[model samples]
Target chain A: MITVSIEKKLRTYGGGQALKLAAEFLTGSVTKIYGPSGAGKTTLLKMLAGLVRPEKGKIVFNGETWLDTERNIDMPPQKRKIGFVFQDYALFPNMTVREHLQYATHDDAWIQRLLAVSNMTTFTSHKPAYLSGGQQQRLAILRALATKPQLMLMDEPFSALDTQIKIVLISELQHIFNELATTVLIVSHNLSELESFDGNVLYVGNQ
Target chain B: MDLSPIWLTLKLAAITTLLLLAIGLPLAWWLSRGRSGIKLVTEALITMPLVLPPSVLGFYLLLAFSPQNGLGKWLLHTFDVQLVFSFPGLVLASIVYSLPFMIGPVKSALQQLPVSLAQASYTLGKTEWQTFTCVLLPNIKPSLLTAIVLTFAHTLGEFGVVLMIGGSIPGVTRVASIAVYDAVEQMDYSSANNYSLLLFAITFFMVMAVFIFNKYHAKSPLE
Candidate 1:
């Protein structure tokens, strides 16, 4: 299970305000995060992934304290073993599709399996520049799964895919998440896109 | 054609370029990523050579390498080495004079990279060094190449700082630039013309090659 209670100061266009959030995620369940623009949905994901520091917070994952500001205990992102897919699909420009997976793991068989699941087998040597938006998004998802992370945080992970592809990939991803027994958190403002996810929703906004 | 000065100039540019890469990588990385008050002070010190008059920098360097100053005396007493009027002194002066050429390109390249790339690497369990070498270095190859070529070319053309610190000594401190000055002072136009032509040809070839390579292979993603 994962538990978080955090507060952070945010500067929005209108004015400055404080963001406070508290939540608990079961060990192997999917959670969808939905909110208006600038509601700190992305920041919440970043904070959970250890990419951002909250002003005062405690994040505990499976009884391990990832962050406890009062006690001054903070484990860096690398040791936390979490997977994150950025909204921009942050693929390394210099690395090819195969190289991206190889960077995360030495298991060639696992890489081959991931490529097959993503239907990217033929594009292994292609760099991100050559891939279409949907392809790049799939690559981002595959790369995040390359390590078989126990916790996955994805921000609009299916925003670029067509409806047909999104449905098929989401089904495949659900199977993969179940097999890995990984707890997943996905943020998306489009409700229909995440209809197949079968998860609880967390809303963030003016409140 | 006294080839000794040509060889010495090449040697100096090569060593200085290599040293600049060693020093510039970490310094540029720090400058690009760090958010601290001390970064401003360090950046100002590094950029001093860019705007300050070369002769003024040379004048201070000459004093420091005179064997009368603390650094010069310490070097002499510890290593039996004299910096002033020596080949090593020429390299030291060239490094200072051409520092901005190397650091500027590298810092810009690093800063332009999206922060997500580094964050992705970190979540993959790669250490900072691994991320820098495996991810950042490969993407910024063009900038590194430009930095190297510019620093070498700049060092090759340096005059005032080298003159003040190293002085003209045959096959020791006399580089191609200094040799050209000496030949012209003696009305030896033929020797001066030869040195000038050689420098022009080599420096032009190197710069052109890098530009061509970047155009064909290392074009930025924005392009």
Candidate 2:
């Protein structure tokens, strides 16, 4: 289980607002986070992944104190063992599809399996620029999974995919998430898109 | 006309470019990644050569390299090395003169990269060194190419700094630029014109090579 209580400063057009979040995620469960624009959904994910620092917070992951303001204990992102899919995909332009996975791990079997799951085996030698938008998005997902991280944070993971690809990929992802028993926190604006995942919904912002 | 000066100039530019890569890479990396008061001060100092008069820089360097001074004394005592009016001195002066040309491009390249790439590498359990070498370096090839070519070209064109510190010593301190000045002083217009044209052609070739390589690299499938 993972527990978090934090407050971060966010600057919007109107003024600055405090994004105070408190939540607990059960082990091996997928949690969908939805919010309006500029509601700090991505910030919440970053904070959880130890990429963003919160003004005040205590985050405990499986009894490990990742962050405790009162105790002055803060774990760096490198030690967190979390996978994050950036909104822009963040694919290394120079690295090919296979090279991205090779960068994360040396396990050949695992890499082949990931490539198969992402359906990008044929495009292994293709760089990000040569890949289609959906292919690039899938490669991003595959790269995040390359490390087999325990916790995955995805920001609009399917924003670039077509509806058909999104549906099929999410179905495959559901099985993989279950098999890996990884806790996932995905942020998306559209709720209906996540209907197939069957995860608990956490809405942010003033609706 | 002796072509030794031409070879000497190429050697100096080559050596200076290599040294700048060694020194400037780390400095540029630090300037781009570090956020501290020291970074600001160090950045200003590094950039001083860009704006300062070459003669002024050379004057200070010459003083520092003289055997009577503290730095020169320490160097001579420790290593029995002399710098002023020597080939080593010219190389040192060239490095100082061309530092910004190398560092500016590298720092800008590093700064332009998205923070997420580094973050992604970190989350993959890779160390900072691994991320820099594997992730960051591959993405900044163009910047490295630009830095190398610019530093080499800039070093080739250095005259005032070379003149003030190194003087004209054939096959030693007398680089192509200095040699051209000597030719003009000796009323050898034909030799001066030859030397000038050679330097111009080299600089032009280097710049053109950079443009062609960049265009070809951009068009390649890996891009």
Candidate 3:
């Protein structure tokens, strides 16, 4: 199980406010962070991924205290074993599809499995720039899964794709997650887009 | 054809380019990724050489390398190394002279990289060094190439620093630019013309190649 409890202040433009929340979940369960822009949805995800520090709180994942600001314990992102797929699909431009998979996982068997699951077996030699938007999204998901993390954090993963492509890719992703039993936390403003995924929704807003 | 000076100038340029790359890459990387205050200070220092007149830089270098100075005295006493009137001394001067040429392009390229890439790499269990080498460096290859080429060509055309510190020692520190001046002083106009022409031709071709490659590969940076 993963547990996150954090309190942080958001400062932008000309104002600031504090955010406080506590959440917990079991393995293989998908959790959707539903909120409009500027509601601290991404901030909460970043804190859980160990990319951002909370002013006062604790984050415990799988029995490990990843962050305890009061106790002065803070684990970096790499040690947290949490995969984050960025909104922009931060694939290394210099790396090919096979190399991107290899960067996170050295095992050929896992890479081959990911390629088959993501339908990227045919374009193993192509670079990120050459891939279409939906193709890149699929590759991004496979890249995150290659690390075999206990939890995956996706920030607007399918927002860039067209409606038809988005539906196809989401269905494929749902199948893969079910097969692997990987827990996922997705952040998005679109409620309809996320409704199909079997997950509990966390409605975040100004507090 | 006075090939000796030409040969010495090429050697100096090549060595200075290699040394500048060694020193400038890490310095630029640090400056680009460091805090704003540190970045400001390092940027000011790196550009100081560019702003100062080359002769003034050479004067300070000459003083610093004199046998009486601390660093110079230690080097001479320990290893019999002479900075004034030596090939190595000219190389040191050229490195300072052409530092900005190497640093500017590299720092800009590094700054242009999305912060998310590094953050993503870190989250993927790669250390800072691994991310720098495996991810960042490969992406900034074009900028690194630009830095090396510009520094090398600039060093090839340097004159004032070599004149003050090098003393135009034949078969040792007499680089092409100094040789041109010496040839003109001795009234050997034809030889000076030959050396100047060859230098101009080589530098021209290199700059043109860089421009042409940039034109064709402009879209490559978006990736």
Candidate 4:
């Protein structure tokens, strides 16, 4: 389980708005972070991933202190060991799909399994530029999973997929999460997108 | 035609370009990451060569590295090396003259890349240096090519700095640009034209290579 109480001042067009969030995410549980646009949803995920720092707060993951401002203990993103699916996918243009997975882990078995799970086996030799939107999204998810992170933070992971593909992929992801007992925190602006996710909802609003 | 000047120029340009690549990569990476007063000042100093007259830079470098000056005297006493009016001095001068060309395009491309790319690498447990070399640098090949070719071509065409610090020493300080000047002074129009034509052809091809690389690697609509 991870406990977080972070206060970060996000810059807005008008000025700065302090985003004060205090929450807990249980292990092996899926939590859908639902919010409006510019509601610091992505920032919250970034904070959890150690990609962004909170001005003041403590983030304790599985009883380990990932962040503690009072003690000045802030772990870097490289040590966070979390998988992040960025809004833009963030796939390297030069690397093929298989190479992307290889870069994250040396486990060839795990890489093959991830490619199979994401239905991206045939596109392993293709670079991101040659992949379709849905294919690219799957590659991003597969790349994130290649590391076998305990916590998976996805930012609108299904925004680029078709409905049929989304449903099938969601079922596959759910099966994999169950098998791995991975905790997931997905931020989505669309409410209906996560209807089939069947996870607890955390609606981030103005503090 | 005394081809020694052509060979000397190529040697100087190659050595300077290689050294600049080694220095500029780390310096540009540091400069591109964040903003600060120190970084701003350093960037301004690096950019000074672009606008400041080559003679101005050469004059100060000449003084600083001259055996008569304290720094140069210390160097001469300690290492028995003289920079002013030497081939090493020409290389030093060329590096200073072409620094902006090496750093500018690479820095801009590094800055323009999406921050998420590095973040993704980080979350994958890659170290900062690993991410920079394996991830960031590979993606910016077009810009890297431009920076490298421009630096080489600019170093090839450098004149004022080389002329000021490195006097016309045959097979040593005398490069193609200086050779062109020397030939023109002696009313050797044909030799001057040969040197000028070579430089023009080399620079043109280098620029064309940059254009072709950019065209091939241009990011298509990823969405």
Give the higher-lDDT candidate: 1 or 3.
1
Best by TM-score: 1
DockQ, per model, reads 0.71, 0.66, 0.72, 0.67
Q: Pick the candidate with the highest lDDT.
A: 1
Summarize candidate 1's per-residue lDDT along B1-223 as a digit string, tens digits. Answer: 8989889999999999999999989889889995788988888888999999999999999888889898888999999989999988888888888988999999989999889999999999999999999988788888889999999999989888999998899989999999999999999999999999999999999999998989997756422
TM-score of 1: 0.98
**TM, every model:** 0.98, 0.95, 0.94, 0.97
Which wins on TM-score, candidate 1 or candidate 3? 1
Deviation (Å) of A95 in candidate 4: 0.8
Q: What is the TM-score of chain B alone in each candidate?
A: 0.97, 0.96, 0.95, 0.96
Ranking by TM-score: 1, 4, 2, 3
Give the CAPRI class of candidate 2: medium
Model 2 has fnat of 0.82
Candidate 3: which pairs clash?
A: none
Q: Give me candidate 2's TM-score against the actual structure.
A: 0.95
Query: How do the residues B1-223 of candidate 3 rate in per-residue lDDT, one tens digit apiece?
Result: 7699989999999999999988998898898885798689878988988889889999999999889998788889999998999998999999988999999999999899988888788778888888988898889877887888899899999998889999888889888898899899999999999999999998999888888777766567743
**What iRMS does model 2 reach?**
2.1
Give the per-residue lDDT of model 4 (tens digit) for B1-223: 7889989988998999999999999899999998999999999999999999989998998998889899889999999999988888888888888999999988998998899999999999999999999898998888888899989999898888998899899988999999999999999999999999988988898899888878877765221
List pairs with backbone clashes in candidate 2: none
> iRMS for model 4?
2.8
